[model samples]
Target: AQSVTQLDSHVSVSEGTPVLLRCNYSSSYSPSLFWYVQHPNKGLQLLLKYTSAATLVKGINGFEAEFKKSETSFHLTKPSAHMSDAAEYFCVVIGFSGTYKYIFGTGTRLKVLA
Candidate 1:
């Protein structure tokens, strides 16, 4: 069994400041984790992914995440925040235990301040 939780329901950051969105997961085995972003009325876009290959993974834009096995955390971070970054972010996980089951987080809304 696997589940994911987005630590914050909302996150606000100044235009030139750093952004961080925390996510924690509980899985019975090593699972593939992913981060997706959605605009007001747009589709989900793949932000980044963490497989067995690399603990630190980079994705589109300036976003990046580190897979911490010990802490069971995959937090998303960026050096600077942009108004376009305002959206809903979801944490997803899929465990390879005979089935392709996906668990999704509640999501975190990012608000960018001018």
Candidate 2:
């Protein structure tokens, strides 16, 4: 079984500062991980994804994440924070063991301060 845990329920960052959101997962095998952001009354958008291909993955809005197998962690980071970045972020994990299953984290809400 695969499960995702978002370490923080809320994160606050000042504009122009760096942003970091932590996520951890557990799976019997290598699993696919992803970060998705959802704005108010909007659909979820893919921030970044980690497959077997690359350990470090980059995505839209200057966001990036590194897959660490040893630590069982895939943490999202941004060089700079923007007001528009304020949203709910979810950590998702997909594991394929005979059957495919998806596990989602509780989510971390990001608030950008001027």
Candidate 3:
């Protein structure tokens, strides 16, 4: 089975500070990893993904994540947090179970404080 876990349910950060969203995944086979962001009442946006490419993947809005197969982790990070960055982030995984199935994490709500 494949699953994803968002380490923090909620994260509060002041504007201009660094941001970190932790995620860990478990899979029986090599999997495709992804990060998505969702604003209130808005559809999900693709942040980044890892699929046997460079371990360090960059995304929009100065966000990036490193895929570590050994650690079973894909943690998102940014040098500084912006007010607009406040949203719900999700970690997703697609296991090679002969079909396309997305395993979504519970989610991590990021609060950008002034």
Candidate 4:
């Protein structure tokens, strides 16, 4: 079984600065983790994913996350923030509770400041 937790309800970053969103997870086996972003009035979009094949995963819009197995954490980061990056980001994991299913974390709302 696996579950995910988003550590922040909101994160504000200045435009052109770095962005970091924290996430933690628990699983009985090697878990697959994903990051999704949702803009206002739009559907959720997959940002990145960490499967067994990779430790560091890169995603769209300059976003990336590293899987730390020891810490049970997968934190999202971007070197530079754009105003358009303002959105709701969710940390997701698949759980094996009888059947495999998706579990989502409490989303982190990112606000970009001018």
Candidate 5:
């Protein structure tokens, strides 16, 4: 079975500080991992993805994550946080075989303190 666990349900950060959101995943085979962000009442946007290809993956809005197979983790990070970055983030994993269904973590809510 494939699953993902978000380490934090909520993270609070100042506008200019760095941001970190931790995630752990378990898979029976090579898994596709993704981070998605959703603004208030808005659609989910892809932050980054880790295929079998890249270890260090970068995405939009100055966000990035590193796929660590040994650690079984993919944690999202940003050099600097923005007020607009205040939103909800979900750690997702795609099933290894059969129907390609998504497994979403509970979600981490980012609160940007101005």
Candidate 6:
């Protein structure tokens, strides 16, 4: 079975502080991991993806993640959190079989305090 768990349901940070959101995944096969950000009513934007290629992946808006095969974890981080960065983040994993489907983690809502 394939599944993803976000360690935190919500994260609060001051305007210029660092941001960290944790995620863990389990898959039956090689997994393609992804981080997606969703603003209020907007659609999801791809933050980063770890194809079988890179263990350390960088994404847009100063976000990045490191894939740990042994720990089965892929955590998202940013050096600084901006007010504009407040949003909902979803950890996703695409099945290795190329099924074009995704398994989404519950979600982590990020609040950037001004």
Q: Give the TM-score (vs. native) of candidate 2.
A: 0.95
Which candidate would rank higher by lDDT, 4 or 6? 4
Model 6 weakest lDDT span, ten residues long: 94-103
Off by over 4 Å in 1: 95-98
Candidates ranked by TM-score, best first? 4, 5, 3, 1, 2, 6
Q: Model 5, residue 26: what's the lDDT?
A: 96
All candidates: TM-score: 0.95, 0.95, 0.96, 0.97, 0.97, 0.94
Off by over 4 Å in 4: none
Better of 1 and 4 by lDDT: 4
Instruction: Give the C-alpha miss distance for residue 108 in model 5, angstroms.
Output: 0.1
lDDT per residue as tens, model 1, 1-114: 899999999999999899999999998888889999999989999999998889999999899999999999999999999989999999999955687867899999999999
47: Cα error in model 1, Å = 0.5
Q: Residue by residue across 1-114, what tens digits does model 4's lDDT show? A: 678999999999999999999999999889999999999999999999988878999999899999999999999999999999999999999987688889999999999999
Candidate 4, residue 77: Cα displacement in angstroms equals 0.3
What shift in Å separates residue 105 of candidate 3 from its native position after superposition? Answer: 0.2
Task: Give lDDT tens digits, candidate 2, residues 41-102.
Answer: 99999988888989999999999999999999999999999999999999999977698766
Q: Per-residue lDDT of 24-72 in model 6, one digit per residue for the tens?
A: 9999888889999999999999999998998999999999999999999
TM-score of 1: 0.95
lDDT of 3 by residue, 1-114 (tens): 999999999999999999999999998888799999999999999999999889999999899999999999999999999999999999999965687888899999999999
Error in Å for residue 5 of model 5: 0.2
The local lDDT score (0 to 100) that residue 91 gets in candidate 2 is: 95
